[model samples]
Target: MTESADDAVLALPDRTLLILDDDRPFLTRLARAMERRGFEVTEADTVAAGLVAVDKTPPAFAVVDMRLEDGNGIEVIRRLKEKRPEARAIILTGYGNIATAVTAVKLGAVDYLAKPADADEVFAALMAESDDKAVPPENPMSADRVRWEHIQRVYELCDRNVSETARRLNMHRRTLQRILAKRAPR
Candidate 1:
């Protein structure tokens, strides 16, 4: 009977979930909890590395920490969508900004969860996953909007290099030069 039950559990559909968070303890606990629920989890401590993980294996769901030592989580959500448009995204964040939360929702995340999100909350967001598409429709200022969504993406990709930022964006070095030139020094 035990053998039969084990086989039955093994027969269940496999769900791939990617977790991106800088907190090692939280990430490990989160991964283990989901694993107990039958999900295969992949983890990354940095946004740049997380993007590579998604590129290597597209996940059905992603739980992102809003803040990272290397960068913010929203950009990770946006990049995941770019890679696998259908992957459901849940933002697990300690820093809750109404504007950022609303902006995250606009980018295609299924839900924005505050940090300390429990297994139940994670499961609930996963259950609430939808293919309804990003809100407000796609637009020309998408680059700008996504840029505005979070500056971390650019920072992560550029390795904080402004010269390389232009290269990655495929714009003239001088063009990126002009754009940043307009911004007040941080």
Candidate 2:
């Protein structure tokens, strides 16, 4: 008799999970949910704090927000990999982009998920034995939505500087401001 894949995931004993996010409420909720799922959850609000926590006790798994108050979540994932090479990591972000997603994967993250991911999705990503089982997006973002998100991510990368963002994007400052002023397209 052999244990099924689901059984193997459920049988993972009280593994430690480090969750890094600036959103306090979401972090707390996710920590609790993962805890209930048999993980010892550690929470951090910034990349610095998360790095400190990782140094103190490297978790077997990590779920990191792509954006943090102090820095990008990629730093956390990189540090965790340094401390524990086999540690599984996932990147979660509200601002998803192809560049950042590729960077996350390059930095040793097993998966990248957009924001509003529930515990089930996070768990599945962490417990996955192979990338072959990765699910394709059910409803991929529209081109307009992708462009909007990319502009927003670039703006953030430029520290919310309208002029710099415009320069980097090769657009007029006023035009960038107008785009930023409007609500993001769905």
Candidate 3:
């Protein structure tokens, strides 16, 4: 009895998901949570590792960080699309911006989500179809929250150098520090 190729393929379950993030703790926790949710999760801390994983076995779903210790996650999305055009990709970032979100969508990401996103949110983004109608946010971000997010983004871009961030923002270093010390506004 010879097994057909299609039969062999059907014998394997398809629940693979790839998660790439530079934050070790966050990556570990997210991977574990996804596993609990019944996905066969593969994780990478850098772009290179992620590319390798895509090459080996392109996942059915992917959650990629916008910034990595080595490179941006957009490259990973591009490569994944090359290998698996049907794969759903979501770009996750702590430094969210309209420009980057546009780029991510163009690179084949199904969604772009800001950081501190829980596993449930990530999963929802991954599972949502491209044609699904998006529900607009009930309340948009306040000016203070936008300012706080911009400051945080600049601080990360400066590699957490308070003085450099302040200089770039044209603000006093002490003032920047004080604002950074405060919790984000709603």
Candidate 4:
């Protein structure tokens, strides 16, 4: 009797991971942090490079950015899942949205996280075994803080142009400038 694909014993993958992001500083920091947490980290700065890395050897885990200069991170994640079906991946974005998050989960991503996520949170998400509800934060962001973050996000999206941000947000340019100058609310 010949052994089939189903009959073959599956080998557990090692703790190898790929981190793909366009932001050089964040990529370096995340790589160092993930290394400290015991993942053999491989870093790529573009979707093309990410694809090359995946083709070379598909990692057991990945953290891909939602948008990049070369292409969308979804392509990289798609290819990784194709090569390594058991791979667990996550999508990180500076701006979070429901549609993209839904797509990422459908493509085998374990979770989608907004930017500025700490190393501990990323680690926990990677290691979670069940699709259990996340514990709510005891001290969530205040309304003012949320508003400030929204403004900042819009500012960045508008290429940091104060006038453009103000116009898009339907606020006075001077008022937008004032908010930009102040420190973020806690």
**Top model number, TM-score:** 2
Tens-digit per-residue lDDT, 135-178, candidate 2: 88767787888889899889978999999999999999999899
48-147: candidate 1 lDDT, tens digit per residue = 8887888898787899887888887888888888988888888887654456678788887888776667786776677652654433322223455445
Q: Going through the candidates in order, what is the number of backbone clashes in each?
A: 1, 0, 0, 0
- Which segments of candidate 3 are over 4 A away from where they belong? 1-13, 136-140, 147-186
For each of the candidates, the C-alpha root-mean-square deviation to the true structure, in angstroms, is: 11.1, 2.5, 6.9, 7.2
- The residue pairs that clash in candidate 1, if any, are 93-115
Off by over 4 Å in 1: 1-14, 129-186
Q: Of models 2 and 4, which has the larger lDDT?
A: 2
Give the range where candidate 1 is weakest over 10 consecutive residues by summed lDDT.
132-141
In candidate 2, how many Å is residue 32 off? 1.4
Note the Cα lDDT for every prediction shown: 0.73, 0.90, 0.87, 0.84
Candidate 1: Cα lDDT at 61: 81
TM-score of each: 0.62, 0.86, 0.72, 0.69
- Model 2 regions more than 4 Å off: 1-6, 153-172
Error of 3 at 34 (Å): 0.9
Clashing residue pairs in candidate 4 are none
Better of 1 and 4 by lDDT: 4
**Two-way lDDT contest, 1 vs 2, winner:** 2
- Cα deviation of 65, candidate 1, in Å: 0.7
Model 4 regions lying over 4 Å from their true place: 1-13, 137-186
Clashes of 4: 0
Sorted by TM-score (best first), the order is 2, 3, 4, 1
Tell me the tens digit of each residue's lDDT in model 3 across 46-138. Answer: 999999999999998899999998999999999999999988899998777776888899989999888888887787777665788765644
